[model samples]
Target chain A: MTDLSGKRILVVEDEFLVALEAASMLAEVGATVVGPAYHPAPALQFAKTEALDAAVLDINLGTGTSESIADTLKSRGIPFIFATGYGQLAGVDPDAVVIDKPYSQAQIVAALRHVLA
Target chain B: MAVVPQKDETRALLGLTDRLYRAQGLDDVYAAALDAIAVMLDCARASILLFDDQGAMGFVAWRNLSDEYRSQVSGHSPWQRGETQAEPIFVRDVRDTGEPDWLKAALAREGIVALGFVPLMANGVVVGKFMTYFGDPHDFSAHHRELAVAIARQVGFSLERHAAEKARSEAVRDLKESGDRFRLMSEDAPIMIWIADSQGKCLHLNRMLRNFWGVPDEVGDFDFTSTLHDDDRAAVGAAMAAALRDRQSVTVKGRYRRSDGAWRVLETTARPNFSASGAFMGMIGVNVDITEREEADAHKQLLINELNHRVKNTLAVVQSVARQTFRRDGTGDLEVEAFQGRLAALAQAHNLLAAEAWQSASLEEVARRSLNGDADVRIAIRGPRVELRPKQAVTTAMALHELYTNAVKHGALRSSEGRVELSWLTAEAPRGSLVVRWLERSPQPILPPVRRGFGSTMIEQALGADLNAEVEMDFQRSGLVCTIVAQLADTVRQ
Candidate 1:
């Protein structure tokens, strides 16, 4: 682990439990967890106001609208990783770290470290 | 019967015998002549056997026995040509006859024969054999027997008259059976068949008509118009009425109430039956039961519609999965198979869904699709009707298929000793939604995978998003427990 403590991490997940898990992971390393929003509008709004060190986005937002939030995060020079069921976001964000669905704690941490490095 | 011949009636030249011969046709001539000869001979039976050019003798009439015996004994009498006899040859005890095989066999089969073969000659030329049979063995009387020879002379005078009448009657009977042949074939056919006169009054009905309608045999005597169902009777009656009024043909498929009180579907074709005189008499038709075939056709159409819906949903899933999966690295047979495997899983799920007519599938069905294994599967589906949309059905099918494939690659189900127990339960959610748990359990030891693959992502994320459920899988040291909170309202389309 790269000791992502004190890092302000923005969580953008549609599922409450998954959001809890992401926030728990960031909190374990002493970082701040900003969001577990089901829809993209609140997530994008939260990203605009909050100082985000990084972001975790659930690829399937309500009404398939995750990219608008992804664009918002990119504008702020924040790094993000996509957690998705369908592997359908190739051309949209090829450079971002992608954590496939059903990720283990170790794999999620390792992938985030690579993205932040 | 004793005959008293009057001397005075005899004095009138046999009482207008000349006038009787002139007025009576030749058949009456043979009858009158044979009666007069019977009186002189005092024989019990006297018959005329006219010989044809083929030399076969035929009994034309009889005086002693009734017409019945005469017909039986003298049927196409077998007298050959060149067997000329100046005197009558008496056949006594003909039952013990010599075998030209047919002659002796025929006599033995009939059980009686006492023939008197009398050949009539004209100017030393043999014309035909005049034959008679006696009921008892009696010597021919000199005066009476001489009268039989004279009777034979009168037959020669009227042989042509007898032959022409016999041929005419035979031709009429042949034509009648020919007409009835068509009637017999259509009536006996398995399909319901019947005929009605131009008035639409049923005239003939075959056994099939009664059988298909479950009617008794006597139903043929009743009117067919009475048996039709109430809704169909009016239209069927109208078509029949139009056909009869126009003297044209009619074909109809209608419902009729059977004798068992069930309505049956019958397809009928009716055409005008005309007489030899060209008079339109009736119509004949056949009806067949098409109920089973119609039901099969309807089921097939529903399947086609269901298939179209599945295709559209599967394409959407593929479009999303392909774009995301290929984003990382879009090359190789491995990725393609992975993609195709997802689609195939979806297809297999659809197959099961289609089997159930798009109704809710058991968790076992989903599990069976998800895993590839040599293990026995036990399914426990406990819930109300949770009918899946085409999208839901496909996604579930594919997820299970991928799970099964992974299991086959590495799990308890991969070995012969293992079995998978797939169970589902619906629990009340906090927001009034429903939580459904799909748990795959086994007796063998297991461990969670070090790395989650594409299969895991599809099952955990895609299905979660679509179903609005949180899926948690804990790979226990003993087995696996996947707790899924599924909102019923999210899974089912409104």
Candidate 2:
């Protein structure tokens, strides 16, 4: 029931296979993928400079937290959902939606739709 | 003939006896007895000598006698050893007595021409003798002899009473000094100290313990169980009681509440105190605060749990990668090999992360590890030292692997003479940006792939997206060239 056509979504994930699958899934929905930045530096850059409708962010990027990117997205009024293997992301915004790892494609698309709506 | 003592003399003798009985010490008794004897006998000097352990008489008390005379004539008693019930010896004139010449000279030097030695009998034994010396020679009277005998008896009774009193007081003083020292030591000790009676009743608490419990200094006979944690009070109390009953030592750990309502872990060790006769006296205990040590141990356990959780999550990520890799069209055994290669790359990154406590890894290390199986003669790696965060390290490792696999299959590593040049450097202009390039060279004509496969897709799309870098892949006639430029400002240490 959700239409992602023409929408540009940023995907920030560290794991290569996960990032590729997420990009492929967004492309399947006719949505344009802006990026799948692996680390916090480039993820923040894309969040600040890119034309994004929504975003999927992994809370932990292996070395440190991706909290700065989440803050940038929040400041720009861009809707996003956290993609993490962890159950709880300490210090994150309480109202932000989180999708756990090994998540199905449908779960991500549904979360993105809910936030974008 | 001598007449008996008048009524006044009888009254004075009774008063002297009363005073002797009331004397508090040996000196007081000796003074009173000497005064009474001097007045009754009307003598110039008096002295009391007691037999020492060697049966030699030593002067115990004297009145108006020269020290030299007392010392020289101390052992010159008229009676032999253990000679009790003997009549008093009255020397009307020492010049005519058949005593030793030195004894006569010593007595004469002190102007004593007459003397009387009356034995002091106590419990029908002559423990000592008292002497009365007259300055002028005079004939003895029967009444005077009776007076000497009576005075010596009173002196013997008084000496015994005074000696008993002296011994009792010395014992009392020693007991008090020992108690004071015990209290002082316990009060100044850093740890809490306490004492309980044989019946398990609290008898004493040191100043430190009193302050800890917020109790007064004089507070004793209070139940210590009230200050213990509710859950541990019963057990600790039972253990202490059992130890007391057995007259043995006990060691226990429990939580006790402080005055400010904070609970602290305390380790108590108690041992039984005993008297010289081996009677069970009481229990003495010491309590040490161990709260901080317990907290530190708990914190270490939490860190270990977190590490185990992270390891499990890493394995899950590996599983997901395998699933996605095999879920493609035309996938076969080759896909398995490629998948295993990628998994190995991930594991290498993990090893580097683990070595650094999962903080970060080095860029040159990641690249070198990914090229592990490649022929060393055909590959050259040149780079400045650069460290990457854990996420960057894993992504870069996988990207490097894809490049290496491609070079082996169709590029520089496909032939023995072929060579691959891999190098990287940091850019200061953009401040913390890194550029890494891979160039392959061979004699065979190089050709570009007709369509993008998983390898190329990962090298260009996955690496670029994950690293947030600029990826450039050019299929030149010379060979396959790949350039990756990423800012390490946020990912790497300066």
Candidate 3:
């Protein structure tokens, strides 16, 4: 029920249905959605070029890891939470929040809100 | 009255008696006896004969006697066989005696004009006789006959002592030789071998075992448990003690540190050894190294664990996809059908992954498998062989399934006249890239949908996110065309 009015958030996830559901949930909270980049390169491109208030990143993007994208968001001071099926993320920043896969919409949105705060 | 003995004769008699007692072997006894006979009495020749099991007398020692004379006259004795109390036979002259003609001729040939035979006694039994021959016929003195009797008694006792001594020494030599042979064989053996006494004291260790333990050859009374790994020491020691107490053979496996400080797995088998009288003597053992086999077993266990983890993760992903598909507004049988199709696509990808040991799958193969329900004539797939890692293959299969579903519902595969061309090629880019194109040609005009559905979102967003690809889907009047370009080298895991 937290107000995400006028907040711009970028979502990066590999699964199409999962990413779409996550994007729709953010839109319902009144947050404008950016590219739900399926691959790391596009996600990195979005992280560098787009105007983002926050980001939701799937740790594994079928092609490789989203570590480069995570790095970009950190450097830009954009708050983000990691979404993954893995128990541990190798070479990832320890301070970053993680949301396990098959997560509920509430879980994703709340984790993002907490990271953004 | 007895004549007083001369000083030289008395000294000679004393020296001969000392030599008879000091004789070490049968040969020494024979030599000492011959010297005594020559020194004590006047004789042309002397011989000693002993009776064998068959009661036949054979000359064992002789002095200055021809082989022909000894052979011809050896059996001619004054007393019959087993005559233990017979008195000496004195032949004043061989020609005058009532002996056989051949015996007289043989004695005459050797110049024995007179001969005296004195019986030898051992343990109060007459065992043999000694003969003294004089060149000229003479009357026998009672003193000379008494001296001959004393010489035979000394010689007879010495022969018995020498025989016993020889048998004892031979037995000792045989035992030593057998022990030496056992040591030599153990030293050359490739496997570790050891022997321990009845009290569990180490008696011997082979060369291989010594080198493995970094111990010297002469090291004695070692406890093998000292070298055992800490975890296995107590148990192994207890098993060894139990086996020893039971006097039974035992086989055990344990870890022991080698000379280089590496712990190696060893299987040891010890068997109890016993004496001829069935007394427990000791144990002999052999050790074999099995470290490599143990390592291989551990590695297989680790792989099984990893496989279990992967299977659980895959199931979670499937669950997520199902929940998302059913959560959509106005979702019904059609949505269920789509979900089932996606699941089938995921299963096909897993099959390909399994076939390749979960390493990589061929891109062309995944495309063909995803579009399986469509007739062969409706879909044309053209692509060079390109292998994708497991993750890439699964994501690509889901994307292809969505594309096929759309084609069947609203695009090319809706009508018999429709056809879809799927082709992919690798391009040499900075990171090396692959470009896959799905071109649909339908007889009916294709129209762009007013709202983006799950299929379009998957073909564009999910495909790009998973593959790090640039996706473009065009809804043209003629057909629905989709183009995907992804970095090939960056996506594959080494």
Candidate 4:
């Protein structure tokens, strides 16, 4: 396993339990887990102010999409990946890595490595 | 003196022939006949009569006869209709013997003492008669009788020709009228209508079709395929060509550019046209605009996609909750992993169902996915193509997951040399019954567990209840063998 120690990763998800699960998974991988933001508002705020190595975003956040956070992360020259449950990717940057919902730990880790590389 | 009169009659007959030939109508022919009769027969008055539809004679053309005198003599016939080869009659004097006194009185009142009746022949049958009236008593010689017959022949031939011409012209007029009516109806129709020639060149386009293509209302061949969308052009052309080659009916759908620069989906149904004598004339087609219907279908597909996305997200949330509730410390890690594996198998089944819009899924796919680790090397899957309903597929997938994990932990898969074989097939005896077998073998003997666990319970109890299946799990020293048998209903077998 690749060590991500001291690397800060932000987890943004609408579902509380899902967000907490993703955060703990990142912490187990030796990375510093940032805000497990449950909505687009805090997710956007954290995206605008936080210094991050990478971001894992859920494309749909109940009220609206997390596209604004993705856009801010792009402007800040940060790499990110969109994890969605829609079966297919749509209306997003073509370069962004997309993973389906209920992703395994190995899939998430591999995707993080590819985006950060 | 006899030869001089005979020459005059011959000349008169020739002159009559010229006039009859140039006559424009039946009325002109009747006039010529009346004039020839008066001149050649040496009579001051003559009248032409023909048979009406009721078989009675009526005066059609006359000269120098009073209306009362003509009406009194009407219906006078010396020969019946359809009597062939009849000779003309000579009533040298109406005042002679063997005559009714009333007819004699009427003839005398009009100052007619002599009359000659000549029969007109058509198609070798008597059709009508012509009469000559003289003011004084006279005798008709053989020359006078022969002259009258010649004149009757000319008039008979002309009447027969006129009848034939009239029937022909009426048929032509009726045909033209029907054609005009068809054009009027086609132009006013709501759908686009077109007619093509045998060579596939469009010969006619109704008003709706012309407006659809923004073409002028002129009679010229138009290439209807020019306005078809690029992607649909080749396909539509090929279909039409095939239909034309075989002279068959065809239906094709494509996108066409309308006059307003918008694309509209159109479905055209066309049939081959034939003439009365069974000759291939061309094709006639009707086009219906279906853009609205196609758009509605696409919108429905989008809605189904959104719904599937929501369901997957809910499944993801459930997985997260299960993980949070189960402690991840060493003692509880195995339980958490087991729960997650079961959830993943269910999600995999859901994915398969969703791909097919939740209709059905194949058994081979469920087995391949559930037998996850070293499946290609250590396991053999053999089955005919079998399909199951949504509920049956989910249960079957869960059962396979349990069986696979159990073999890996405590069954045949725990030994390096162990192998597994799975097979399924349908039966005809029970009318669509299904049978599946799973056999595991290892060099080391396997033992039956003392206590049942969740995996065995799921495979044996839940699966059996959900599918109405009869399942048997046999633990032997050499391996473990599991068999399941179930009936497939017609509604769920796909």
Highest DockQ against the true fold, candidate: 4
| TM-score ranking, best first | 4, 2, 3, 1
lDDT of 2 by residue, B12-32 (tens): 588779888888777777788
Cα lDDT, all candidates: 0.62, 0.79, 0.78, 0.83
lDDT of 1 by residue, B139-224 (tens): 55554455566666655544444445556667667766765786677767877787677777766678877765666655545777
Instruction: Judging by lDDT, tell me the better candidate of 1 and 2.
Output: 2
Off by over 4 Å in 4: A71-77, A88-96, B1-220, B234-253, B267-289, B328-331, B368-378, B415-418, B476-478
- Model 2 has a DockQ score of 0.08
For model 2 the local lDDT of residue B335 reads 70
Task: Name the regions of candidate 1 deviating beyond 4 angstroms.
Answer: A1-117, B1-337, B353-385, B427-445, B490-494
- Alpha carbon lDDT of residue B282, candidate 3? 84
Candidate 4 or 1, higher lDDT: 4
lDDT of 3 by residue, B1-494 (tens): 23436675677677877887786667777777888787777664788888888887889899998888888876666655567586787777778778778777777777889888888776566778888888888677878878887777778677667766777789879877986788889997999998888887778889999899888988676677788888997777777877868879888889998988989999989998877798888888999998998889767644643453355346446655665557665568566556656665776676566556566888888888789656367898898778898888988999999889888888878898999999988876646588899999999898887788887777788778778889988888768889999876665532
CAPRI level of candidate 4: acceptable
Q: What TM-score should be assigned to candidate 2?
A: 0.37
Instruction: Please report the interface RMSD of model 1 to 1 decimal.
Output: 12.4
lDDT of 3 at B82: 65
| TM-score on alpha carbons, each prediction | 0.29, 0.37, 0.36, 0.60
Q: Could you tell which candidate, 2 or 4, scores higher by DockQ?
A: 4
